[model samples]
Target chain A: MSRLSINQQTVKQLSLPELIRACTAVGVDAVGLWREPVAEYGLVRSAELFTSAGFSVTSLCRGGFFTAADPADRRRAIQDNRAAIDETAALGAPVLVLVAGGLPAGSRDLRGARAQVVDAIAELAPYAAERGVRLAIEPLHPMFTSDRCVVSTLAQSLDIAEQFPVAQVGVCVDTYHLWWDPDLDAGISRAGERIAAYQLADWTTPLPAGVLTGRGQIGDGCVDFPAFTEAVLATGYTGPIEVEIFNDELWKRDGAAVVAEIAARYPACVGTAS
Target chain B: MSRLSINQQTVKQLSLPELIRACTAVGVDAVGLWREPVAEYGLVRSAELFTSAGFSVTSLCRGGFFTAADPADRRRAIQDNRAAIDETAALGAPVLVLVAGGLPAGSRDLRGARAQVVDAIAELAPYAAERGVRLAIEPLHPMFTSDRCVVSTLAQSLDIAEQFPVAQVGVCVDTYHLWWDPDLDAGISRAGERIAAYQLADWTTPLPAGVLTGRGQIGDGCVDFPAFTEAVLATGYTGPIEVEIFNDELWKRDGAAVVAEIAARYPACVGTAS
Candidate 1:
């Protein structure tokens, strides 16, 4: 059976220890942890619990929020990312997903925001490489360009990755963010081995308030899962499929039920190995 | 004074006659017509109303929803576009805005959807060329990619336009739809003289239920209007600045009031001409 990873963001209602217990109880092969929860449980303690429970830590929730108005703010973001890298290494997570932050507060210059992101990533790349954890820049949907992320296109993400010589900087392809791109196939082919993590979620209409947290569950929206998964697989990424949803409604449901739904949805995204 | 063009879709609440009266009362210099309204008013009568009121027809509302499951359906779309072309000539609009339709009814194949769009445009381009009306393929926001239009990027729109001679096919650069593209400069520069129309509107959060009708008035959202206008101007486009908003809330207010707001908002988007 293909491995199933439950992203902590999908079940923020639970404590890190509770999330670990939930993962084990739900037949989840892995659990993806976010920084706050891990810090709350203490990274060492959380890692031990997962290892003891036979749950692999697929990936660290996130490490990038790079765009900032001032050089000092930018430096602070990089420093925080450095700590996140350390946390990922301690937790035994191979990858730390990077979400390029949007336009700096009150800034309308998208070009300037993008430049800050590149600079921040470049600064953190070396430190992350030294820590033995890869940084995967996740390109959010274009709608989030203003307040969430400026890197709205896969080509844009690949362009940023191309800037760094070391392969430590790669891309995290999340279905909800990228199913709309016209050049997706070409982008997947170009990414090839530079794909660090493959995350799945669905895109739906009537997106909720706090747009960041409205992601749909797999098979809950219009995205063609089988096709999207096949394209990413064509890039030769055989890593564990991580189910990441940010639905407010889902968080209110029973954690075990949500985990079961994700487990069922995981195979729909990627075909089950016979 | 800078020219103000009214797109009918923005004031979809009013009948064609009332819409023209609203425009004339507000001193709107131009108006964009749609097929249903024109057909409802009859082409000759619709042409006479605009002609008598001395309003320049900036562009036709739309003509492309090309992706279809069957060849017959595709043929029907082409024929409908021909009728739209005829109506554009009747109303004296120099440009016809084309929105490439979304995925074929049940199909989730994005690439295939785009290929169908190109073929439909190729088929319709020749007819529009002969009719003296330029086809302006408007690239919609990615949020609408599933149910509205498949051409989600300016680069993709221009790439399609490049397939034909400059005069026959072009793209409409609508600020509300394309304000978030990372490559806005390069895309606008590539559009250059092939830009058939330059439309304006703002992007707002808590988007309306009918996604197609939720555009904000200029200066109301996160879009950098001065920069957006400057980018279009840098492309050497000296066309009429069309203000189009599909807000149901705005439409519920007096059409004249809405027109006045657009007139007031226009200067903010494109500062007073020197």
Candidate 2:
């Protein structure tokens, strides 16, 4: 194993400090911490705990929700993202994950909402660059187009990234969000070394409620992990394959058991050793 | 008013004969008949009723569930599509819509299933072309990728059609299926004159169960209809904008009233009047 990073979303059931302790106990290599969890543990204490355990914060979970009808709220969102970048920097995380906001209230114009995303990102990029924080735009599934994200395709994400200089802008290629894309290969090729994060999860059929929470664990469903991993590696992404499952069933299980199960399954799905 | 077609699916609650009478009462210009409706009304009587009511048969409501594991069943699917072509010919529909089948049962290889779809279409395209019936591949919503069709992208559908020698083998650009595509403009441009149908409906948030039947009526949700209509027209598709909503709410209404509502809403969402 090169290194294992458990996305905090996988063990969302655990507190941030508890999640860190759990990762250390399992001899895990890294953590992808979310905002709410950090707030719960208090950012200062959370940083102290990670530092004490010598844990690496691979990335911070989220700093974008840019669509807004009001300019004041939009500006506030940017400020919030800047703070998120500062927190990520303080925690020694390399990238700040961004879940671009859904449509403005009562707005049916996705293109218009998408424009807001572009403009917001363009404005945020320079500030993020100054802070030495890479803004990794994660393309959510198309089903989220109406209410979660306007950037539904990786190509679109890359296109959006092109507007800003490559130094501080890239994408988080989460398989849960992108497994169904027909242009996935081309998108990954275009992404190349610019892919800041390589997240993995299986896509279960008959999506439940078609929301953010129905994600499956690696090898539990249809994603060709070996093939997709090969494609990502071909693009020179040698990062840890971050396992980030959002299974409700798994959430209900014992956190330690889930972590062990994931640890066991990880190498089988992505390892060269058969 | 060029030619109004009542897709049998629009009034799924009513019997085929009842739907026919309702279409007649509402002064519909034509009928897009479904297989089940045809079976109920008897193909002979369905033809008789359309002829008597002076309604043109615009298209047949589907004939392709092509991806199958068994070679015999695959062959049977072709034969069934041939029958649909014959029924289309009998009822005088210029086009026979094809909803290509999805991942085969107990299979996770979508790529293999898609290859099967390409081969199946290649075989059936020739027969439909010879019979003077246009075979229109409807690129379904990505949400239907698991069990409905492997051809989820408009670009993919156009790629498949490019294999056939004739222009008659084309695509059906349904708004509900395609509105989320970031490469929509490029796909529409490629479709050009090869687009056989332009179906319209809005995409609602938190889609209902039996999602096949949960589509919203035109102008009822978030799709930019006028913009989409303009793009399709830009591709040289000046065909009738078929308003094809599969909503339970619309189905519960009187068939005549539903037709009236569509008639009132469509022109607004379509191209600007000269």
Ten residues in a row with the worst lDDT in model 1 chain A? Answer: A265-274
lDDT string, candidate 2, A206-251, tens digits? 6666455667878887777777777888887766668888888889
Q: Give model 1's docking category.
A: medium
Expressed as tens digits, the lDDT of each residue in B29-107 for candidate 1 is: 6887778878887889888887887778898888999999899999999999999988888788888999999887667
DockQ of candidate 1 (2 decimals): 0.50
lDDT of 1 at B197: 92
User: After superposing candidate 1, which stretches have Cα over 4 Å from the reference?
Assistant: A14-18, A25-27, A70-72, A272-274, B13-27, B206-210, B272-274
Q: Cα miss at B29, model 2 (Å)? A: 2.2
Report residue B65 deviation for candidate 2 (angstroms). Answer: 2.2
Q: Candidate 2 lDDT (Cα, whole model)?
A: 0.81
- For candidate 2, list the clashing residue pairs, or say none: none
Candidate 1, lDDT over the whole model: 0.83
Instruction: Label model 2 with its docking quality class.
Output: medium
